[model samples]
Target: MPISRSFRCSVFIGVSLDGFIARRDGDLHWLTSRGEAAGSDLGYEEFIAGIDAVVMGRGTYEPGRSYDPWPHEGRHCAVLSSTLPPDADPRVTVHRDLGTLLRELEERGTKSVYVDGGQVIRTFLREGLIDELTITTVPVLIGTGLPLFGPTGGDMPLVHLATRVFGAGVVQSSYAVDRTT
Candidate 1:
């Protein structure tokens, strides 16, 4: 069962109304505070179920490493980092280049990926490698923090696929990358 080379990279994340994924100290308190009303997950389970693997930046992986029990269990996870410490989690492999990482995953039969972390997502977007994005906008706005999108070289057009509003005042939108643009 060889993995197909036609890999689809997608992003599923939540950002504050002002566009910050995490607070100044890398805290996601504002986002997590509104925990899925009644374990709803706000469609995260559906999105993640379609992904074969997860890729994130070193900054994102480090924090999860400290969790009592790792968050992404039973999934092939890769961290993009050149300076990843030697004690990094055994469950994850470190890589320096995004292209090479995707190629390796594709060769392993990975068809879809969930691209995560602020820096990793921005880099993938800038490279025009992202295929789809499902961004959930949390109502509360944090004045300052890390933004989800930084300046890419040029404008990247996205085609709206769907939109949903949750009872928690959260708005989730899905978009397909307009590669032809």
Candidate 2:
């Protein structure tokens, strides 16, 4: 049985038309290049504005933590990894147990969290914790790469919320996870 969640988990990410989130080597060059040329955040600020906390797995952390200007500044960030490097950003709280992490966040009154990384998203989704998902599809398809989602053992339905077109051909769709069958 799945446990109940008082806090909300949300995913805001970009994907290629082929359904991959990044290249096979974890490179986001294709995705970043397009966004930079388009000169749009594609509603990222608004989405982050609603997020009180941030959680991601080691794969996302390894790359995201290397940026010069750290993302998710001023928010409590948590990294889900049991094998994280000793020198990981000291600002982030590392957790080996997802359930405990979620429980603590809920107890702290965290209303919403921006859940990132492919594996982390799938884990949360499988646990029936994700409340919403916003996927921005770029025009280019890189053939094969890291997919945005994977099998979760069973079907999880979504309620369509809205879709918007960004600069050029970027299409962003928002969906509410339908918990009520």
lDDT for predicted candidate 1 compared with the true structure: 0.84
TM-score of every prediction relative to native = 0.91, 0.94
1-181: candidate 2 lDDT, tens digit per residue? 7676667889999999999999989989899887776668999999999889999998998887778788878898888898986456787888888977887787878888999999999999888888899999989979999888888778888999999988868889999999789
Candidate 1 wrong stretches, greater than 4 Å? 1-5, 37-39
Candidate 2 runs further than 4 Å off: 85-87
Top-TM-score candidate index: 2
| Residue 24's lDDT in candidate 2 | 88
